[model samples]
Target: MMQPILTVAEVNGYIEEVFPEVQGQYLCEHIAPMEARVRAVVGPQNLRPGGTVSGPTMFGLADCGFYMVLLAMIGKQALAVTTNASIDFMRKPEPCDMIAEARILKLGRVLAVGDVLMYSEGSDKPVARASMTYSIPPAR
Candidate 1:
């Protein structure tokens, strides 16, 4: 198995420097090989009608989680951009933190594909699943 090229702190630092707008919304929990775990801190603003976490919030968590995994394996390539994404909302997520487990399914020279499974905090059942493909910029 390939080891991660970046650490959680390093990845978080890069996000803080470049994507400051999402500073406290998403946090990298772990990175190992081609996998990463991320947490989305759910707040009142993240809830929709019925007091459940919104689909967009869960989608953001999956995107962030997959991005973290890709960056951990490929280093700080900030230009990597999501090219395609699809998500399935399985269950209503509670108004609490959401945990995302992301794994890289394939990594190529200019593209990477990954999937994420998200669950409400402290829950064993997944609330959503997402698959995404990112276009990696060529090295300069």
Candidate 2:
């Protein structure tokens, strides 16, 4: 298999250059990977009253992860649009940190599909899973 020519630095650089605002509350790791992983230190800002990470927060995390992975492959394309999303909350997340591992299931000229499995830090079981599809804008 061919090694990915881009590194995390390059991918992150593109992200910073294109969608500076896409940077989320968590830090994204493993850019340019066949898959992407993001980690967040959970706090009141991301949690509900019962100490569970809020659904919206998890959704945001997975969304950002998907965007980042697609960008890593397609490069600095901020106009990519979300076409669909399906998320499942499988288990409760840790009250402290949440991690999402995302991979692209398909990458076509005009469309990209990906999924994310999120886990609470220190836990082996997934807390949630998100499947997303993105529409890449046709070349200008």
Candidate 3:
């Protein structure tokens, strides 16, 4: 297994520094070879009319979790952007914090593919799953 280029705390700090607008909402809890664990605190803005977590909110969390795992493996490539993403909403997420566990399926020179499973806080069942691909920019 390859060593992570960034620690969980480092990735969290990077997100805070680069995406301050989302600071305090998303957190990188753990990071390893090609995986990362992240959490998104559910706020009023993330809740829908039915008192459930919105699909867009879960999608955002999944995308960010995948990106953080990629960054942990490849270091800070701010240009490493999501090229495509497909998310399936399984169960209705509770109006609480959501946890995302992301794993990289492939890490090629130009592209990275990953999947994320999101669960509502304290629940063992997954509420959403996302498959995503990212375009990794060439090294400068």
Question: Of the candidates shown, which would achieve the greatest lDDT relative to the real structure?
Answer: 1
Clashing pairs in 1: none
Order candidates by TM-score, high to low.
1, 3, 2
Candidate numbers sorted by lDDT from highest down: 1, 3, 2
- The alpha-carbon RMSD values of the candidates against the true structure, listed in the order shown, are 0.6, 2.1, 0.7
Query: Which segments of candidate 3 are over 4 A away from where they belong?
Result: none
lDDT of each: 0.94, 0.80, 0.94
Task: Write the residue-wise lDDT of candidate 1 on 1-140 in tens digits.
Answer: 78999999999998898899999999998999999999999999999999999988998998889999999999999899999999999988889999999999999999999899999999999999999999999999
Summarize candidate 2's per-residue lDDT along 1-140 as a digit string, tens digits: 22344566766676667667755465667864557787765778888988889998899878877877777777767799899999999987868788889888888899989899999888889999999999999988
Residue 99, candidate 1: C-alpha displacement in angstroms = 0.3
* Residue pairs that clash (backbone atoms under 3 angstroms), model 3: none
Tell me the deviation in Å of residue 1 in model 3.
Answer: 1.9
lDDT by residue (tens digit), candidate 3, 23-94? 988899998899999999899999999999999899899999999999999998888999999999999999
